[model samples]
Target: MAVLGAVGGLLAALGLLAFGLYCCYVRYIHAKYDHIPGAPRESFIFGHLPILWRMLRKQEFMHDLFLQWAEKYGPVVRLNAFHRVSLMIVSPEGVKEFLMSPQYSKDPLVYGRVFSIFGERFVGNGLVTVCNHEHWHRQRKIMDPAFNRNYLIGLMETFNEKAEELMTKLEEKADGKTEFSMLTMMSRVTMDIIAKVAFGLELNALSDDQMPLPRAVTVALEGVTKTRIPFIRYMPWKQKLIKEVKESVRLLRRVGKECLDQRREDIRNGKEVTLDILTQILKGDALEETRDDENILDNFVTFFVAGHETTANQLSFTVMALGQHPEILERLQAEVDDVLGAKRDIDYEDLGKLTYLSQVLKESLRLYPPVLGTVRWLEKEHVINGVRIPGNTMLVLSTYIMGRMERYFKAPLTFNPDRFSKDAPKPYYCYFPFSLGPRSCIGQVFAQMEAKVVMAKLLQRFEFQLVPGQSFKLVDAGTIRPLDGVMCKLKPRSCAGSCQA
Candidate 1:
């Protein structure tokens, strides 16, 4: 009994020692080296997790929290979460350095899993996810032709057609109704645009039954966003989620293959192939020649997934914003009416004349960029803003926060389209709706053209007003969307004459 008691005593002593050592280790990590600036450290074990969680749940605006941190801790702030050290850079100068610097690369851990689920070959080091210097350069060179001015001009008819269909559908839905979810209508329209542009197929998803292809693709995308959470991919629930994602990916792959096969058949038969993005990609001998069938399919999937979701969110928000501010909407209506002026279709040439419409879209993007933030990992140890950051540190730049900074804009919170006017003062790095630099969004032009086309047609045909007492709160899902839905009343605007709300 005495021996056992002594052993227990020794074990207790050892436990106490270990506990003391752990506390010391934590203190060491939490201890601010003069080299590291700005971020307040919490208890070593929890680090910044609690602060982040609280801010995430309670703060309606996350950008505000980051901005506050920047104000308190300087432009660069250090945070530790999930045993990973992170640096948040708020200054435009810092952002420019990182985005432009070749040293910074897409964090593989974050994007690798995304690529894995989407299938490795289809993404084939595509522009959105790839990091390798040589690979990205090659991919960018090959993909550049698809976004040329001539091709975009060619796509104008399709954009107008889709927009007309959208307007007509909304008008029909608002026949007796005071308000409907214009947000949903816009989502469906953008999805249809992406389908037609990328695949040479007009899904017409706005009016049609939910197609299996888009539905599966959306599900897979949702899975990827959730799986990005640390260790969530390993959980049983997440494993099942991943399983569903894999199944959805397989379905999408099959659909993509079918589409490609059809295109190939048309090519072989000497039928005039559509001048859509997919056709252009297939015809381009540079990348497609070296890429396999699966790689090509991955690229298509990537394009569809990235292209649709971001634009859909932007379009939805733009409509919601215009609806909330009737004056802006009224002005937009007048502009569209004057520009199109009873034209059955808005041709490519007319787009240049619709400068006001472009300004509204630009302002909306500035207010709420489709991508709130992007993460990039440091490939080498680097100093940012006089702080030493070790290699592999996760660096985050919140475009949402950056867009709202007073340093970047005057009256940052207000929704003013005039800021982007021809005579208005421009600030460097102030607007990055599609991001800036070589790694910027490849489909930006396509997205803008589609939004303008849709918005113009809707303004020409219908007038929208925000529903009273309806909260249009921004919910951060894959993209920012209304927490409930964007419930708005629509009254058709007759082109023959102006009508009051």
Candidate 2:
């Protein structure tokens, strides 16, 4: 009996030893083959979750650390987060390759649920979320006309009108203040611009009273950003929050559908379709044959979400950067003064002449790009910078870190508009504010024009200076925003003379 008991114990011990050996072989031997260079790894169970959390908490200069990692490791590094392995690619060449590759697709698991709120008929398989190659091609062909240069030029009046209203609103708010949160103000302006341009609905978010549509959209986005945390996904409260978000989405869709239905009715009654994006999208001949209402709604939601948030954040960052650098602001103001003069209205043609303003906007985008990182999943195995990446790997390209890498630019940390001047030597893949290749942002020109008009108009009436004792730190949420909000004293500038206030 004693001998039999000893044998059973010996067998259990052997089983344990074999399992440990298997684990070591998988972790040390196999991992070396699959891993990218320079990326730190976590233990087999938890992976890099703790490291990622620490980096995320630091907030300030986190991008700098990412750049350092890129420099230490090769351009491509493999990081494990909560058992999920991710590839971080920092080189401009690598970024260009991944962004341009047809094999790479946006990870729907990361973006799908929030997008599903747009309803199955309108969003279930829309252009932004659809993966089928033929569908993408067809949708792109139909959507291209809406953002064409001629179409954008036609929208300039809408842009100008919104800008004028925004200036008046700012003047009222800044009557006695020297500093205000430009982030909040710019959010309002961009929301109003998008609402008017996209839906032919005038939503004056710049006013003190919150507009219902913008408020609902803001609530929905806030909820979406919160759900991104892994811990948040497990809580019961998360389910409740998601339910609330769906309700908000329903409200937003109801509003959108009402507007769309009204327009469609008008078209049927022989009224000519307006030049708004919604009009073009809903009534365009390109999509006339497609019976997918879900796809149409998806596109609408994509435009609504993508259209305002990043642009608004970019504008706010531009203002903060301008406030910090008085010389650049003064130069921009001079250009605005020279171009627009005392005229209250600036035409679309006049926007082209604001060369210095364009440069300033370009520089701001470089320093604090709206999107810090973009992720694409490989449909097939691929080699990036001589490193073999397996299929289904998430490739994360950090624009935020790349813009600050010394290898990419001279004095990359410094905000200098001169870098974009005609004499500046620029490499092809180094600077990609709007991304590159076939999948590049189709609305780049429109976004640039809108930013220029809004910034030009604001600079004409106000001189912004950073407020004292305010903690204006980057809050890297959905887009990089100021954690405490940007507090700046705005002194109204005379349109006719120097901005002495």
Candidate 3:
């Protein structure tokens, strides 16, 4: 019996030893991109994950760290978090090659994380989260007509109306002493616009603070962001937040289901439904061999989340940037005054003439792009920027990092709108706020039009000042937004109705 026990103990010890060696191999020795330059590994087992976690814990702008690393480690840098390896690609050549080609698909590991939040299906196989090339292509092709030129041009009235509603809301608070969160206001307005335009439902988020959709969308995004943390579900103190997140996601799906059902009923009843986003989604589903009800809900939720939050973040950041630079704000206001001339409803032609205003918005996007970047999976080995990157590698392309790199922009930190002037050289492959290639955002034109209307009206009517002592730093939610919500005090401009620029 003693000999038998000794044999068993020896086997168990050997098994543990084997497991430990395997872990060491996976974490350290098995690194495929070690030849690529990067900061020294901060952990034997976790790689650079600890540093990332530390940055998250400290509420640091994590992208800023990536920017610093890019400067130190060149364009193609390596990063490891546990068994997963990613190469940060900031070089123009890498960007052009990987993003422009359809062969490089989205990394499932990167996008699949958002498919479900804590086991509740969030954006399940939606256009944004689907990694399969054929699937995404099918979805994108069907949805393209909804965002075509005439369709977006038709949305201008909805954009102007919702933006005007926002102007009305701001008038009540434009006392020069009342402090308000510009982000919250922008979020509400954009939510109203998207809900009405996409779903044909009046969310009225601008007038109603108690609206459920806006709050649910925010909570759902928080849930998505929290999923990035390893074992976050197992944390003791996060139970309340986790529960809230689940509930929010469920609520969003429930709303989506109800909206889809109602739209289907409307179609059956021969109701004259406009060719809106929901209609496009239903039309897409009809063309498929087998209908996917969950995928439909996935798109429903996806549009609501994507259509609203990103533009809100963009507008809020633009407001924050303009508030900080009064001279730029003055110039923008002058242009708005000259073009708009107290015209409450801005025409499509007016948008073209707001050239400086366009520059200001473009510059704001360069500095504080709401959608930072994307991830692609490289299936085969490729040499980029004089470095041989291994196949089956996950590549991270960060607009946040590239936009701030001195190699790409002159005075990377400065908020200079002239960089986007008509004569200025366009950023080759470094600047893609809406991304590039076929997978680029379909709502780019829609978003920009809505932003212009809102911003143009804001410049026309209000003179806003940044509130003192608030952190102007960004918070990297699913999309980056002003950490402080862009607190501001506003007063109606001296020439609110008309200005002789």
Candidate 4:
């Protein structure tokens, strides 16, 4: 009996020793990014996980932390979340290799997290979140005609009407002493515009603050961003957030089903089809290559969220930037006055002519892009900046960090619209607010058009002032929006109704 017990003890000791050796190999030897320089992890097990959680919870500014790491460790820095190792690749060559090819697909496991938030299919299999290259290609092709110039040109009528409604709403608020959230106003208008232009649904977000669709979108996106945290779904305290998000998802999907069904019924009734995104969605369904009801619903939520959210944030940031720099604001307003001249109906031709307005928009996107970065799943090894990167690793490309780097832009922190002027050389890979290459945002044209019309009309009507004590800090809740909602007061510009400024 004593000899048998001794033998069992010896075997247990050997097993623990083997497990220890394996952990050492994974952490110190076999780890893919072990060679790269990075800030030391806060915990061997947690690996900066707690730091990220604290920062996110506190609503602290964290983008600059990544930039700081980049400055210290160079562009291709390593970061860890628990045992998982990911590379933050800011090198232009790295971006070109990873993002330019269909070979490196979107990190499925990473984007897949967005598919179902709190047990609800939020984005589902939409164009932005889908990882399958072939599927995304087919979907992109089918949706391309919807954003064509002619189709978008017709959208100007809707844009003009919705933007005019926003202006009227703001005119009442521009008392020069009453402070209000510019972002909220922008959200309402863009939400209304996207609903009208995309699905012919009247969200009525502009006039009604308590609208069900807008609130649902807000809650649904909250679900998306919150569920991203590690082990968040398991926490007892997160039940409220999870339940709210799931309900929001249900609301959005339910609304989508009704809208799609109505559109199909209209088509069956031999009704004249309108030149809107709903028509394009039906066209895609007609194609033999792609016809899935859930996929169509995925796009409905995608268009609603992606269509309105980013543009609203961009306009809000632009307003904040203009408010801070009166000279820049004056110059932009002057240019708007020169081109638009109080024209309520901003045409597609006029959009191109508002060159300075375009510059300001570009500059705003550079400083505060709606999307900070994207992740790519690499299946093969590649070298970036003379460093060998291992295969089967997650690669993070951050425009937020790159845009702020001095190596890419001179006075990277300054708000300079001239940097985007026609004569100035365009930023190659370093500037990708709308992203670049084949997987770039399909709604780029539509978004920019919507931004221009709203911005042009706003500048044409009112001169805005920033309210005191408002933080210019940014917050990342799925998409980046101003932390303070861009608190502002406004007074009418000289050209309120006429062509003179």
User: What does candidate 3's lDDT look like per residue over 108-140, in tens digits?
Assistant: 988888889999999989998898999999999
Compose the digit string of candidate 2's lDDT tens values, residues 149-239. 8888888888888888878777776755645677777788888888888877777788756576666666676665565556664688677
Q: How should the candidates be ordered by TM-score, best one leading?
A: 3, 4, 2, 1
User: lDDT score, residue 131, model 1?
Assistant: 75
Each candidate's lDDT (Cα)?
0.73, 0.73, 0.90, 0.86
What TM-score does structure 4 among the candidates reach? 0.94
Highest TM-score model number: 3
Task: Quote each prediction's TM-score.
Answer: 0.86, 0.87, 0.97, 0.94
Q: Which 10 residues in a row give candidate 1 its minimum summed lDDT?
A: 492-501
Backbone clash pairs for candidate 4 read: none
Error of 4 at 209 (Å): 1.5
User: Candidate 1: misplaced stretches above 4 Å?
Assistant: 1-35, 53-64, 117-124, 176-178, 228-244, 283-291, 381-388, 494-501
Residue 445 lDDT, candidate 4, scale 0-100: 87
> Model 1: per-residue lDDT, tens digit, 134-187?
777766777788898898888887888888788778767665466677666776
Candidate 4, residues 1-501, lDDT tens digits: the string is 999999999999999998788677558633667788889888776686777888888888687898999878877888887557888988888888877888888988888887888778888889899999998998888888888888899999999999999988998988888899999999999999999989998877888877887778778877777875778889999888888888888888899899999999999999987867777877888885656888888889999899999999999999999999999988887788888775778888999898999999999999999999898998788888998888888998988889899999999999999999999988888888877778889999899999999999998889899999987999887889898899999898765647662
Give model 1's TM-score versus the native structure. 0.86
Shift of residue 227 alpha carbon in model 3, Å? 1.6
